[model samples]
Target: MTNISPIRVTGLSGNFDMEGIIEASMTRDKEKVDKAKQDQQIVKWKQEIYRDIIKETKDIYDKYFERYSKNNIVSKNSYTSLSIKSSDESIVVAKGSAGTNKINYQFAVSQMAEPAKLTIRLNASTPIVQQFPPNASGASSLTIGDVNIPISEQDTTSSIVSKINSLCEDKDIRASYSEMTGELIISRKKTGSSSKLDLKIDGNDNLAQQVANDNGISFTTDGEGKKVATVLGKNLDADITDENGRVIHINKESNSFTIDNVDYNVNSKGNAKLTSITDTEEATKNMKAFVEDYNKLMDKVYGLIVTKKSKDYPPLTDTQKEDMTTDEIEKWEKKAKEGILRNDDELRAFVEDIQSMLFGDVKDIETLRKIGISEAKDYNKKGQISFNEDVFSKAIVEDSDKVYKILAGYSSNSDEKGVFEKLKDIIYEYAGSSDSKFTKKAGIEKSASANANIYSKQIAEQEKNINRLIEKMNDKEKRLYSKYSALEALLNQYSSQMSYFSQGN
Candidate 1:
């Protein structure tokens, strides 16, 4: 039996040992980095899911409150129509009663019917005090076209008129000399509502006085002008009248009112009692019109909630996807129904009584089933509820207040948890740390210091792993070096013996 002596292990080189330690440290660092990345990804996913739930829930809540539950069922059309004709010229007619009043007048000229021409001339001989260009307040001497005419206190009308006619003889702005009063009467050749024939003055310079003296012509100011009226702290046109008698037409021009043989002065801010009569037929018509509006709204709500399939139908098209989802539709219907259902028992009872009064019978769920508002099985054996819109509309008309109460009560119970509060709780449950085994193992902390402690532990764990790897690598390297050193020594010893043997030989 050959006895093998154990070889003495030698120390490892610094380069060999240090390289192994570095490689082991690098491996452990890479693992920690990967784990951190995965942890971050998990957190991100949790946040995203939470956000999506909150957003979808909020959208459903807003649609329920803003679109279906709001009160907006009032009619606004209550009026009567009237027609009038006139054959006179420049005659104003006021023809309408306090209720359902209207005014229609016309002006006719026989000369306008034929192709006859009329001429009116304007002559400006003496300068008139006219407002300067741009600013109406500045006073300046009148200049017709390009010639400047001067006005004196003693200037005669004829001389001034002659000067004006000579300067503007064939201009479109014609000036004709009047021999009756030795004056120049200025008028436009064309006469229309918009024709500029009135004299323009500088502020309160009294252009009438200037024209009277300069042309020796007498003129009178038109008494009719724009009139203003006010009612309920709102300004309105003085001539406007409510033909239907639904709205009170308060005339601002009528400031004096006789009350019990005593006169009272009313101003813009004051209120006056209108003793005008109303049309009962028109009022009823207006109320009936509101019924139509209410019906339309109810139909819209029903359509959104109810789902139906066509017989022998094809697959849903892309366009169908644009419609509301089943979940959304269900939520909307529930909200609508709730809004119509009043929470207050008294109000609910009152609405029910009103319905009873209108329909002569209370339509409960059983009654609705008898009237074709019950569940029915389709060809696929799936159950679905069908609504009777006509019956539902009659029910609504009979008891609108009941319907209103139901709609106003939707998703508004005070006892239920608020959406925002629920969302916050969900977030807290998902993100918060608790004193549980799973949380502790996952390195979740209750306090800020605990978080810091966890981080410190992770760091220490990483360092310990690195150190263990270094120790393992160092042990392997030491064994490798020791074996190689021993082999090298044995080989050298054999070489020396061979040299001695050769020398001896």
Candidate 2:
């Protein structure tokens, strides 16, 4: 027997829109799905806004709070009072400190320290196998300084250079072969009058003699009747004598030195003078930058605390969007996300906690106002700071230490602590890490993304349930169609039988 597919009847079975009835009946279930979707969208928007606040707070902490906390602002102030002028800058450049007295010093430089170097020339046509001649033991050994490095006939110039460098590394020496010059150069690491580079062949290997002949390095007795060896290196010692004939010897490693708290940069031999003068520019710039960052963070806090909520706008449902235009949907969403963090009590309290530190009632320093930093007079400014240049300049010039201590010190008591410590503690509580209040309350994780895991899982479960409910509703619609079809068939059969009876009469 052939299998026949069942036929589906529509309006022929009943004078009713069955599709419309099914849609109307399932409206409540569809609403549940739409509400869940809207809720998920809201959670996502909230997570994003919280993450933004955390990020901005962290940025302010690192850029402003951390820098000002550890730094000695008093030292920065003193740095402005120090200046130096070199009469012959080409010969010697100098930088004076606050301790450097105004004085002129004459100096003469005889020599600069140099690293001892020996470059051994090699024949370009020489074969690698013959680079190291065989010793009495048939295996060649090259002795550099005190270490003996074994070499084989198969070793190339590069390999020999590597062995020499590696074996004699502890002797504060390095060896390399210059491909351009076809020469092997050995140099000492340290450079001073006491520094030395001694190289001699221990065996009767022709390699050493070839190396010596290739380079113009020779050992001879000096006028003092002592054996003196000379290499191709230059400027091993930096020698300078003051005008009073006091000699100063230095290694060639650096061209600068600090004496009597005054730093000197040696260029050539000559006289240079240094002077210390009050320079307010550095202190002024630091204070200005600090104020700018302070104002920015304060503004952010004000927005966090004082922003008003849009109670009229709730997240849009799917059905709601279908009836509305694209522009309307956009407008609705903008309003919905306007007040995710508006008037948050905890965040407002945190802002107030940090703002209280700026009141400035430290012991001797008394107040930030005394140091020329004061809050803006306008209530609309929201605790933003302003600086009086003349007042600050006078304070900084007279007593910078008191200003620094007031800003940097932090005690358990609010009276002793500064803005830096108080702000540090507040930011840590709300925006520091995964344990922060913002992270916990919003159910947000510390990640490169803003997706809240808790809400995402909840949404996934809702979607699953909605799908199952939709499938059940569709099944109920099909069964209703079958029930209606059977009734119609029975009614038609009864009508036919009644006609037959009437014709027989």
Candidate 3:
């Protein structure tokens, strides 16, 4: 019977709508299945709401705890401002902290540093074959400072120069030969006392001497014939003097030097001065921004904790929603979701803990109120913090170092971590770790969602059973029709026989 298709036999002889009657009888059972599906949907809505709240809280945590908390809220350079002036900036320039005293100096550059070079000028008639040491393994190897440059016997002077420059681009050295002078010049790239060309050859090799004589290099010492001017591989020898005519020691390797704890960097010969002044305006602005961000986060969290729960509005079912419009459904769900996280103990405790930390005492400063930061006095304000500009600015200007430490100090005790660090600790406790409150709640919601899925599957199975039962009912109705049709044929034959006997009488 299950293998056969259920016949759709209309009530012909019985004159009745059997399918309609069966549907009316099953309406109550169908509504029970629909309600189960609606309950699952309500659970899904709850999971979504919890997830959104967690996401919002995580966003706040990232902004405050991750980005700005670890930094110095008070600007580092805000206490002392340094101004620099150079008479000849092309020669020298200076920037850095100016100590308690003013700095004044006059600098001069006598000469600039140079690199060592060997320029070889070969005659056109000469056979320019490279002179390698007898122990050299091949005619293609040129070793310089443990670095080997491969060369060929057929390589020309120009090609060798190009190869040397290419290979030594990263080696802090370069080689070039002038076509007009026919000189091969190898020199260090930088000009300083430390920048010296390290050129060495085998003791048996006389390549250096041959190149020097061929390149017209003078080897005559001082007082031999004439005074020889300074050459490459020598430091820049310059005399810099202060206003007191005292010699100031300056090196070619660094442009800047510290005098009386004040640093100065000069590129050209010049006179420069450094003056120190207080910078209170910038420090005040930074303090203001810190207070503003703190108050904003505080307000956000407080509002969420105090949200009112509406017990009258339960999650709407599908049947209930069918009679309502889209806007009506939205408004009803909004009220239903009002108290999902309302008066939550975890959130309330977190808020209270943060407030305690903010209002607590710090080293030297004692309390935030002493630094001109205090909570709102109004009961309706919900503990929003306020900063007095005059008092806070004066505190920063007078003792910025102390004020800075009070807010950003590192401490193992929660009472000592200062306001910002304490808040950061609270955020990490709630949202930072996988086992934190935030993650644990998300896990609970996830489990609830899984349970809702099981409900959905159960409801689906019930629906399949309902469909099977309807098929069986239709099959029974079809068999009843077959039996009624046979009975009608028999009755009609008996009535005809009775009429025939009456006619014979």
Ranking according to TM-score, highest score first: 2, 3, 1
C-alpha RMSD (angstroms) for model 3: 12.4
Report the lDDT tens digits of candidate 1 across residue range 248-331.
Answer: 233322334332222223323322233222223332343244334423332333332243423333222233436969786555
Clashing pairs in 3: 91-267, 91-268, 92-266, 92-267, 92-268, 93-265, 93-266, 93-267, 120-184
Top TM-score prediction, candidate number: 2
Model 2 root-mean-square deviation: 8.8
Instruction: Judge candidate 1 against the unseen true structure and give its global Cα lDDT, from 0 to 1.
Output: 0.35
Model 2 gets an lDDT of 0.62
lDDT of 2 by residue, 1-505 (tens): 1132112222233455556766777677677666666666776776666666777777766655664453223233232334555567787776543334444455555555556777766554675545655555676665566677786656777887888788887888888888898887788877654557766554343555565566566654446432334453344234455546676765555456666756766776544443445555656666677678767766765775666767788898766788999999999888888766677766677666655656533443347777787767777566577887667766755665555555655577855665555556777887776667765555444463234444455656767776786687677667867765566676566555544654555
What TM-score fits each model? 0.24, 0.59, 0.49
- Minimum summed lDDT over a 10-residue window in model 2 is located at 1-10
lDDT of each: 0.35, 0.62, 0.56
Candidate 2: residue 257 lDDT (0-100)? 62
Native-to-model Cα distance after best TM-score fit, residue 504 in candidate 3, in Å: 21
TM-score, model 3 to reference: 0.49
Number of backbone collisions per candidate: 15, 7, 9
